[model samples]
Target chain A: MAAEAVLAEAGYAGFTIEQVARRAGAGKPTIYRWWSGKPALLIEIYARQPLDLSGTDTGSLEGDLVAALGRLLAFWRDTPAGEAFTALLVEAQHDHAALEMLRAFLAERSFPLAELFDRAARRGELATDFDLAAGLDLVSGYVWARLLTRRLEDDSRSLSSAARLIARGCLRR
Target chain B: MAAEAVLAEAGYAGFTIEQVARRAGAGKPTIYRWWSGKPALLIEIYARQPLDLSGTDTGSLEGDLVAALGRLLAFWRDTPAGEAFTALLVEAQHDHAALEMLRAFLAERSFPLAELFDRAARRGELATDFDLAAGLDLVSGYVWARLLTRRLEDDSRSLSSAARLIARGCLRR
Candidate 1:
């Protein structure tokens, strides 16, 4: 928890194992023994954080998508943990280990959304041949693009609109 | 040119005015007088390079989008300039001036796509209320997400699929 806080505040450039150990009141050896390094520690911290996807089922595909995306936007806009996760993504570009951990983290995060798609299909809301992976990529991609380009703010209007468009596009005729 | 080459090979971390000066056979003062800093220099180099969008007019929206995105993917995958541009994006996160430059670059790049959307609207292919900005964001966002996450390789299958999907979604029946 202290490490997560430090990561959020310090960013990748400022995050150091020493500071984390000091803040957590743990010995260097204790931290190192349990985790390989910062990437491993960050992954552990990220995995422990709760991602609320239980409310993703809203009966209608459109409602479910908007709610799921709305929650994701809220997490990014409202939480320090979200900032930490972004810092890790940037770090992943140069660090292979971090890239692996980040990929694993992303896959785990996407599972719930995949399940949501499955529910939509079962409800006869989705086309039989719809590409779920591609659809999810578009949904998540729009959010990431805005966030990375600094285009995202407190506004959820665009998020909802994009979700609606995507839902409409992917629905069964 | 030297600065661009240096940026491509050495990346932002290894790039410096000094190295660029030596490579260019120019003095530090000359480089300093013309450009304020690395970010400014990078922006200049990026702007000077040509981005071909002339042939983006393929008549059909799907054809144009696929062509435009295909060119973009080629730039990122095949050119050193693309590598330089990506390094600039990473640098933008830490530098305010760089962020401004990156935003400007992105805006400039989006203009041609906007023109394509205008053509689509004039052709009565798009819904009157279709959000061009949001649509473009989804298109560019998907490409960028894949690029940043290292999930993109030589495959343009997903790009074409997304383009077709977006085109279908935005079209007025």
Candidate 2:
């Protein structure tokens, strides 16, 4: 993880397998043995690698989404992790395997959020007919916007504000 | 545009600029001169591109979002364009120019949607504190879920259902 951090901070142009090996205190050949190259290693590092969603949830659906999304943005804002992942994600847009990996990542996490909406519906917290899928999309869509467009450094307020709107509007149906 | 059509139909490994020129009814040199390469050309096609949202309105917020999303997704499912753009978009994850171009394309479209929500707010249709950002994100996120997950084609009904859900839910507030 530390090695991934260093690489993300430096970028591919400045990346070195030997450095990752050094940072992880592992053998260089060991790193090489598991992966074909830097891109592969980068993808591995990006893989559902643990995101802390502890701060998410605040009683109300909107408040919960706000907390959850804020954590998500914070996860992407890591010094090396965010930038490297962004670049790799851009690269995945072209590479078949990378795109697959990216999809896997989204599927693993995005579904959980969709469930959140579904639960909200069942509880009568939201309209029973509310589209859980759309709710998920709305939240995911905002993240995608930040990643592909602004590439902004996520702050607590931005996530909360976005959550507020989604809660206020999308859940009403 | 034709070049994009061709490339999207064929993977980059199998794609040829000459073929794109022929498909586009333009000469190879002319295409090459403008793009200087394949990646460049791919980005240019989507650059400043627009997703027509004229028919999205359906009186209610959820209805409007569904109609708009349905219209936008129509291109992804029924046309060669979606397949082609996906191929190129997958690649953009790795290529710098591709990332920049796609970001620009997304921003161009997102702004209009954001304004749509704002207009709804002004009309007293939406909660004053609605998350416009989340609304915009949901619109694109559904498409991304399909494209990135490769489920858009296999599950066309899912899109419509999602649309229905959003249409009813988004306007509730």
Candidate 3:
């Protein structure tokens, strides 16, 4: 929580262990005992945020994707999750280690998404030749762009439109 | 050119009029006369880079989208364009004015993309209810995610796959 507070106030440049420790009224060694460093701390803070991906089992992939995007956009817009993730991405741009950590975090987060696609396949909704990774990339990429560009406020019309496109793309003809 | 060379070498933090002038053997005043500051200079240099969207006229929307993405990914991968744009994004993260410029630049860049979609409609390839702006966002967002994550090296297999999904989504059912 102190780390998040510090990150929110000072951004990547000002997010020092000393600052977080100062804010939390805890000793530096105590913070270090829990996490290795800044990137680790950031990840831990971010990972705690709930991404309600439970809607994946919904009847159709298009419905599933739109629901997922709806929850995701709202989560990013209404919570600290968006700020924390944006900080992580900005940090990744400058620090190689942070970039690796961010990539790994993103890859790990894809499991639920992968399941969504797998369920679609089981229902015979997805095209036989669909590349799972590429489809996932487009969906995630769309969300990341909205997050970074601060356009998440546009909401359902745009999202459902996007979902329609992705669904059609991955759908069995 | 000097600005790009400076940016490529030192990145956003070190990109300044003084450095660009020194790199070019020109005076700071001359550089000032040419451009307002770092963000403007970065945009100018980037705008000069050719993004060949002429392939839009290709008969099939899928073919056109694939060719456009192929050229875009290559342009971002092989030239200083990627570095300049990335630096712009990083700068935008920290500076409000830079962020505004980046937003405007991105909006301006969407023209050719709109044309690509409009051409698809003329060809009777796209869905009647398709949202052109949302469709553009997905394609550009996919490319941006690949660039920002340093995954541009994966080449045609991934890009053509992405193109296929986007094209299918927009296709008339």
Candidate 4:
């Protein structure tokens, strides 16, 4: 909690273990005993956030993708956790340890959406041989591109359009 | 040129106008007169790079995309200019001016590729109603995602795969 507060107030550059220790009223050794370093502590804070990955079936892959993406967009726009996540991602670029931690976090976060693709395949909604991972990359990549560029407005139009395109690409031939 | 060397050597965090002025043997005021700040100088450096956007026709959109993306990947990996560009992108997060400069830079760089899409539509290879801008976002977004995440290997496999997917998505009904 103290870490999150520090991260919010000071951002990635100003966030230091010492500051967190001071804010939390805990000794440096105690903090280190629980987490290896800043990246690890940040990961712990991120993992504790309430991310609702409970996807909607909607009886079609397109619906599932739109819903999933909508939730993702909302998560980023409506939550402090989202800002923390972006901060972590930005920090990760400068630190290899943070990059590794962020990679693991992203993989875990993407699991539920992977299941949506799996379900689509089972229902014969997806093409006979869709590259599920690549599809995920395109979908998520578009969202991330918009987010990083500050083009992601609080509307679902772009997300809906992206989902439609991806669905068409993945549809059964 | 001096700014680029300094950027490569010191990275975004270490990059400063004073250091660049010192390295270039130019007064800080002169540098400021030529360019508003570090971000402006970096964007100028990037815009001056010889990015060959002359995509090959190869009689197919997929081929055009693969060739363009291959050249892009090479430009990033083979040149120090790539490091400067990455540094600029990273720095853009903290500076509103840098972010604005980056957005303009990206738009200009993407123009030739938009023309490629236009050509494909004229050839009846793509849907008449294809969303050229959205399509561009998806294609470029996938490439950027791979590059930013460091998943872009030297091989052309990912580029080829992404091009194929985009081509399919843009095909006329």
Name the top DockQ candidate: 3
Candidate 1 lDDT score at position B15: 85
lDDT of 1 by residue, A52-161 (tens): 87967889887898888777767666665555666676777767788888888888878888988888988998766688777888888887776666664756677666
Task: Tell me the lDDT of candidate 2.
Answer: 0.63
Docking class of 4: medium
Q: Itemize residue pairs with steric clashes in candidate 1.
A: none
Residue-by-residue lDDT tens digits, candidate 2, B61-109: 6566555666656666655556556655655555677667676666665
What digit string (tens of lDDT, one per residue) describes model 3 on residues B24-113? 999999999988777899898888888787845678888888888888878888877887887777777667798899899999988988
Q: Model 2: per-residue lDDT, tens digit, A36-142?
A: 66667776776635666654546678777876776666677653445556655654645767677666666675765876676566666875555666567667766
lDDT (CA) for every model shown? 0.77, 0.63, 0.85, 0.77
Tell me each candidate's RMSD, in Å, in order.
2.4, 5.2, 2.3, 2.0
Candidate topping lDDT: 3
Of candidate 4 chain A, the 10-residue stretch with the lowest lDDT total is A77-86
Candidate 2: list runs displaced more than 4 Å: A1-43, A47-50, A79-104, A110-124, A130-133, A155-158, A169-173, B12-40, B43-57, B83-100, B110-124, B129-134, B154-157, B164-172
Q: Is 3 or 4 the stronger prediction by DockQ?
A: 3
Chain B TM-score in each of the candidates: 0.88, 0.72, 0.90, 0.91
- DockQ values, each candidate: 0.56, 0.29, 0.65, 0.56
Calculate each model's fnat, 2 decimals: 0.43, 0.36, 0.62, 0.37
Deviation of model 2 at B110, angstroms: 4.7
